[model samples]
Target: MRQVLLINKDPDMHSDLNSLFQENNYESVILDEVETGNEALRKVVNDSYDMLILNLDLPNTNMLGLINKLRLLNQDLPILIYSLELEYIFIKRYLTSGVNGYCFFKNGDVGEILDAAVRISTGKWYISQEMVELIVEKALYSKKIDRFDNLDEQEFEILTHLIKGDTVANIAKIMGVHLPTVSVYKTRILDKLRITSLLELKNIIKIPLLSES
Candidate 1:
């Protein structure tokens, strides 16, 4: 039987995955709630597993930094993003960052989830049909680069939180960093995205790629 290190918090989802993996002759370890992102990093360092299925929407998660860190720490780990994120543009970065697969349980579709695990375990890549088109579309029509793309993982995290109305202090607490660190990230993200205000950030995320016309 194969094993997966699953970064998940939902018990029901875990239960569902357990049954599915058991039927398919696989098993998984449900990663416990991590107070700090460092704990998750440490777990990956100390443990051995066939796959890593990361849940990106987990609260207080630094989704980008974790990927960057994992790339440096365990370059060969086959990472699969089991995310609820619907935005293909946002997910496109992960696809390029050595993540082996991406899927969602939208409408409770477990088969795709299982398929993602199986494919990645065998050293293959997987991105759903729909997402492929979107990624390609943005790639083909490149003009001036999207400033949003220039923001690193930490900047992206801070930008998204601020766009969602999170205060700088709250974002600091969420990321387990000092208040001033988040402030610096905030300033840097705004500068990189070429936006001066939160209102612009919110609008930009909802629109198509910047300068793609």
Candidate 2:
């Protein structure tokens, strides 16, 4: 039987998911359920599970940090993100962070969820067709004017840190540079990306993921 570790804070959703898994006839069992990222980490470290269904909105832990930690702990374990967050950027980010599948709760039903679980358990990526089309469209548009390609290594690093909510001083300290130097890098990055402010930069990053129609 396939063992699944479910990490979600909503008791109703948890119960519903558990019931779906049990009734699907997929020979899968929700071996453990965790309400927080810390709890998920504890269970993951101590137990063996075939797959993980993660909710990205866990209150106690940073989502990206937890995903990174889990990837380090079990490189081969399949992780399926079952999240209400349907932002294409977040979906791309999660897949890049080593999640095997994404099931947007807003757009998915029990069938999609079950399919994601089965496909991910078999080492296949599971994403909705609409998401796939959006990714492809964005890829084509990106090839036309790849703004990120213009950033140097340092500028790219600075941009990443900035997006991660790092302050200019913090970035400077982390990069072993003066505050003014980090500020200069940030300015150059903004110029190269063709964006004026951090807010614009964030919005630009999300643009590709936005619905075309």
Q: What is the lDDT of residue 59 in candidate 2?
A: 46
TM-score to true structure, per model: 0.83, 0.71
Clashes of each: 0, 0
lDDT per residue for candidate 1 within 141-195, as digits (tens), equals 6565666677777777786677668777888887789998998887787776767
Root-mean-square deviation of each candidate, in angstroms? 2.9, 5.7
- Stretches of model 1 off by over 4 angstroms after superposition: 27-36, 142-144
What local lDDT does model 1 show for residue 115?
A: 86
